[model samples]
Target chain A: MPKPAPHIDILPDVPLRLNRCHEACGPGADAFAFTLAARLNGPVMWISESWTPAQLNPVGYSQYADPAQLLMARTKDQTDTLAVAEEALRAHAVRLVVTELTQPISLLAGRRLQLAAETGQTTALCLIPQGMGSNAADTRWRCTPVFHQADSTQARWEIIKNKAGTLSAWDVRWDEKTRHMLVVPPAGNRPGLADASG
Target chain B: MRPVDGPFALTLHEANTDRIYCLNDPAEGQGLSQGMGLADARAFCPDLQSRPADPAADARFLRILARWAKRYCPWVGLDGRDGLALDITGAAHLYGGEAALLEDLHARLTRAGLQVRSGLADTKGAAWAIAHYARGVAPPGQTRNHIAKLPVPALRLPEDTVTALQRLGLRTVDDILTLPRATLTRRFGTDLLMRLDQALGDQPEEVSPLPDPPSFAAQMSLPEPIGLAADVMAGTERLLAQVCTRLTQQEAGARALLLTLRRVDQASQQVELRLARPLRDAARILPLFERGVSAVDAGFGIDQLRLEATQVERLPARQLSPLHAAHQDKLHDLITRIGSRIGLDNVHRYLPADSHIPERSYTTAVAAYSDPSGAWVTLRPRPIRLFPPEPIAATGHRPPRHFRWRRMSLSTARITGPERIAPEWWLQDDSWRSGLRDYWQVDTRQGRRLWMYHTPQTPGWYVQGEFA
Candidate 1:
């Protein structure tokens, strides 16, 4: 068994173990990672594959975090993207690093990134379209756009596994005016959500 | 000692006539002069043996001789097609003096079977004229007096200009110098005076020397074959140290280093490392080589190693780089380490561009080459991921309509008002050719907020972005 590393937090409830890698897979995974990046201080690095046919819109990213603090590394291959993300984390040049992968990486590659992130004290997030089934990551997140009831605009982030053992799930909304993620109370009548288009 | 038993001449066809381009000393003595017709030269010397001239071979030979003359001085230029120009200003003292230097050059070339003429002067024009006409070293500051008696052709003017001056009896530099300066310019243009001024040291004539290109490479062979990765890395480190020392001596930094390994079976393997910036530090370079060193397979015990700085740039010492130097170094190191895996060009940042269109609001600039500038100010609601528009199948233009996207069909639970975006009339965009768009931020029942647009001109709906 590999050694356990301390978890780090980008937001309040999302305490992702540091030196270890966590992942958010399936639909809306990148958006969940971007929400965490908004809370991180210092520089951030993002890695994506070149032929993915999708573009990152900085206009929406600016609403979450300062795009100026973000550095992007686009690789030709999926393996190279993860490898570059590992090196970026190992360099400890940034506080957080995000990687956009077409598919989930293997447990060995994930563990390699975990060790590298631990060495540099960087939190790495691998956002893939498919879930990481039975991987060695610290946690596996599934954050999707959900409303409390009708006409509500909030996101539901559910943690399928947490090595650090935090909350099971949390509901939050991106507050545009304050530029922070406001956690909605789970116990009661919900705060009526504003129009998501704003 | 001659290839021909008698006088020899090399003639070339020029201006529709076979003219004598060059001749040996014996041919000159037999009145078979340069530019003379072959028949006329044969009449002058019945035993004349001649062949065609090769100007291209002569020019190549001249360049070779110029390179050889670099032993006298680092600055050497080709004077026309036949002469050599040596700028032995400070270099002459090494061979005793200017006259001694000329004598040594002339003696060494003469021993090589060349009838070489030597000259020593302060300027290229004076030296070339002396080598052709005077054939000896002339005293400094006495160029005007020395070349005053030489023919006007020694000034290196066009043949027509020289002939025109000769027809007017301005046969020597002294004749032209003695005339009114304005009258000379009026008669022969500035070229004649420019040459005379260059000879008399009134105008500076720079000798653009042929530079010997510098090579940054090092190679070493092992005493015995060792197939271990440690042994290969050890060899690589040693080679890198040697190359770095040489690079330090030249004040240069390597942007890319190529390390090649040779095995006992005569197979070669290469590991290349590219950097985001020029680097020369051996300690900093050793770790970078570590990443690529393991990838090379040491087939059948490697026996030789070579490291070469394939791309290099100048990196001078900085005096006031003390502040934030450590911070900048770590960032650069990170960029380089990541850049090596993904290409250096792939590492970049998105800088905000002033545009009303959602897609054109930001431009990705390679991080190493640019500075972080411009604050991203989002004017309206935009999605996090904005790919090219994928057509959506809908019944009506209003909200609550069902559409299939990415293998999923979902109905809109909530819809916002259509925010109209018109095409910039001055710009040409093929995507916006369908005309003005009425965008609707729709929250689907399937827990997805999609940015949908209706092209008013075509009256079709399409999904473009995700607000998730």
Candidate 2:
């Protein structure tokens, strides 16, 4: 008799949110990603062409359940850059990988990264805004800023993504003076991702 | 120590890159403003002193302030150009409530001859806003209301952002408060919202609490900077002794070290060393530094010497074996003696590579600090010497039995295997440009066994390694 394969909870295939970097996303995209990484607790990676210390200047790694590791390629356009990033992800047991690239990813590279993420049950958030072509992406997100009509001191972050079920589009109001993010009006009562109806 | 109310403060100012500009007046008649022209300032006050800014001096002063600030609160950070931020949350009660805390701080700073403005709030963002905007200083309870009256600059928005807001006909905090939140984000970006959020205490902003002094660092401040190699060695010896004592006290050993030399001319020279194993004795550490210091070309005198143990491990407290004890002592002695003479970094140990690539099987890491030999416990069947990629004149798919290596023509006596090794498809390594390689162990006529490989895709053979 053949040995039975171990029952595993494979990660479900989720749509990839694609956007052209620097266009749909601004300079603050890196900061936003970093903040999310902190909130997520563990398993986040930031991949980019040109990296400055400012991008990685969050709370130190010792604070996390797993130490935060930053990996880089000597050159951006080099084909081996993705490989290096993959190695880092495997080595560090990263849960999420964020990339900032000037060019769009190839279909093969996207498939490879997706497979790795599925195998590891990791989430990869690729920031590609307008202008760059899609590479077999699972989903696409368009992030834009919006201010509140009642109070100018607050602003709203509108996240429009294709794969977010009924919650594909949502807005969260943020106070400019307090640096606080608040849900506006009726939507404010719902929890994060609560509106997503699969 | 002087009373907290009356600590002496010294202010040093510099003009451009040269000249010293200092004002000893504690009564606010220094005749200088940030944007005032140099010529005009001089004309405004004839006795005004001017000197070029010495950033090194400013850094040194900050370090001093850091040490002194510990007397009040352990958490202190240098806040921009000429300010320090202290998190006096829990520590304030020691001096009494907020009022007494400020009084104590004021007294100490005044005595130190430093001008200070302090603001207390629930958040660092709020505190920062209050400190820069409110009159005198935002009293603790009314921090938010007080900040509202201050100019938009108090929000700490970038100059361009502030200018854009002004152009939008939004003059005050009240004016912006009436506008819609979505409108602000669409026009200004999230940063505007973030700043506003910070002011209203909606988000938490943490001050990186100053860390307690570590036991692994050794520092020496010279009366005058020393430029010669021997002078540097003398300072290094003192620092090593201190660090060794610290390591011994903690029952820990250092495996990696950084030797920092700050030049009198404001330049810095650094040397790093890694060891095969952790070591605590100064005798072992001093020698490695001798070669290291000589390598540092001190363009100017070195004013400070800082030695830091970058990596450390717990030292096992076990009795030394009679046989290995002497050997261990001798090995350590030799390492230290050689370090003193040739410098520490020149010595190295082999560390196992994390990759499967033959050329990457081992790498050179700093001796004395890394477990290089320990990384590879079981030895694989590897050649004693591996040559860098060498070109051969072979044209066929099969590796030629006779090939030239380093101007010598050698014929193969015995050949073993075409071990097919494929390049990682996902990765593009330049060395892998030859694509699939078929490695072979060939015994040559010169009694020299060689490791040769033929790239089937590229159709060529190359000598990769030699056997002992």
Candidate 3:
């Protein structure tokens, strides 16, 4: 019998296979991707080139995990930005790597990241604002803000692209008190939402 | 200037009274001595010419002269407040003989408008005593016999201690040496015995030399002002050459350098540059200053330029590499490669600071130089993306029902807090000038969870951060 592939539970019964490259995009994508980092072990390499007025506060990140576990690299231009990400993943020194790119990824660049991840057995999660383009990524998740009752406001997480052809959507809320993900059952996710395509 | 042969003295004010600090030979001839009250000196000699003494300027001038004395010997140290001590053990042959060296030093300093008196001996204390009491070179190994004839004060005792010795009918160093060692120590304390022993060559004394080349600074004073950028670059390069040469002799390198330019208008500007590694190569260090030097505003015109290495570290010579990257330090290589494009300070790590203020809670440290510390202190819920507080239009101490931020109208959907956090009274913070704040975590109807605070003292509301 063949052994099952290694994976991590992003939510209850929601298993995302590891050792591959994936993309998280849209409004609340940072929180969505940080949830994955909170569950993984070992040091994390995070690369970005954005200069927004506000920065990612480590205090706010304590609700998920210790921000000290992150190795942040602020690279120069687009080329150096992606080059660091590719090199870090290829090193396999870290278990998981995260990158926030300003522009959308092309199929060629996405394939290169995927091969590097496979060679080092590391998970590469790219946090992009643009929607999924023509890329050879294993999965593409889009998160959008939705108005709910109270503190645990539900953010809609829809797996718009799955290479395995498994498509689904769910309302995810983080229970801050327990440090756990509270996913409401799949609801009717509008098709026109992913149609915008960045 | 007063005539060289006139009666003159320098006075210093102390204990609410002015006293004579130094006196010329002519003033001494008139019975005016050091430590005599200025008023008493005037009563004793009506022709005395006196001026206020400046000890700070005199000390600075001595330090400069110490650097110049390095030409006679490699080890030159400042002795007391008004003397320079040079150890010329193996260097006397350069001037033919011991007496020849002293004659040359006295002649050179006399030509430079200075009163020079020197004594060469085997011991520092003996040499000091010989110079002030009897000026000449003591024959080698005859330090004990030579200084035995000097007075008790020549042993460098305190004024009261010397007076006590004189009251005992002891006027010469031989008088104090003839008494039993135990009896002398009991009568005058340990200081008198130690000075006696040091001058007799029985105890060794160390003369720590001054820092080599007067503390790693190179300066150029132009005859006329130069306003062009090229001229400033040339001056900076020349200073770098001198500073790097001194750094090599010390087996160290500069980590931070300050290049200061003084304009003819009396205004000055500085260009500060810090490096990731201890660097001595002028070629590598010069280009780093090019960016800051280009922005120099040479106001009316710059007349003087000085380059000082503010921070230096020991850096032994390493084998030159063709790419400067063949070394096996991976962490250093990573920082250098990224630090070249973005500055080295840009690569940083965030560490937790013990403070209740939102901005002061976490401190940023450059990752290349510092290590990240332990856990983040999270007692209450905090936002992930925080910035300076953005004001919102609202009233009362309650969360705003509707508000606008960055052109988006946000309506409060759910509120979870009124966590009251007052300003640290001990700290003067401009942001918390309104006193205390009631912070609220509001999940807006538009899918944004904002960390907003309301100030009761000022009756205002502001949004500080987002949970996303």
Q: Indicate whether candidate 1 or candidate 3 has the larger TM-score.
A: 1
Q: What residue runs in model 2 are displaced by over 4 Å at the alpha carbon?
A: A1-198, B1-212, B215-247, B250-278, B283-326, B332-346, B351-357, B372-382, B401-403, B444-446
For model 3, residues A22-75, the per-residue Cα lDDT tens digits are 888887887876788787855677777746556778787777866776667776
DockQ of each: 0.61, 0.01, 0.33
DockQ of 1: 0.61
Better of 1 and 3 by lDDT: 3
> Which residue pairs show collisions in model 1?
A7-A17, A7-A18, A19-A117, A19-A118
Q: Give the per-residue lDDT of model 1 (tens digit) for A69-186.
A: 8888888888788778878888877878998877657878878888888888888888866655337777888888884344334787788877767648777777767666667777
Model 3, B330-373: lDDT tens digits are 33444444565456766666788888778888887777677668
Better of 1 and 2 by TM-score: 1
The TM-score ranking, best first, is: 1, 3, 2
The sequence of per-residue lDDT tens digits that candidate 2 reaches over residues B214-247 is: 5699899999878888889888888899998888
lDDT of 3 at B296: 92
Which 10-residue window of candidate 3 chain B scores lowest in summed lDDT? B324-333
lDDT of 2 at B35: 46
Superior by lDDT: candidate 2 or candidate 3: 3
In terms of DockQ, which candidate is stronger, 1 or 2?
A: 1
Error of 2 at A180 (Å): 75
- Give all candidate RMSDs, comma-separated: 10.3, 30.5, 10.7
- Could you give the fnat of all candidates in order? 0.79, 0.00, 0.57
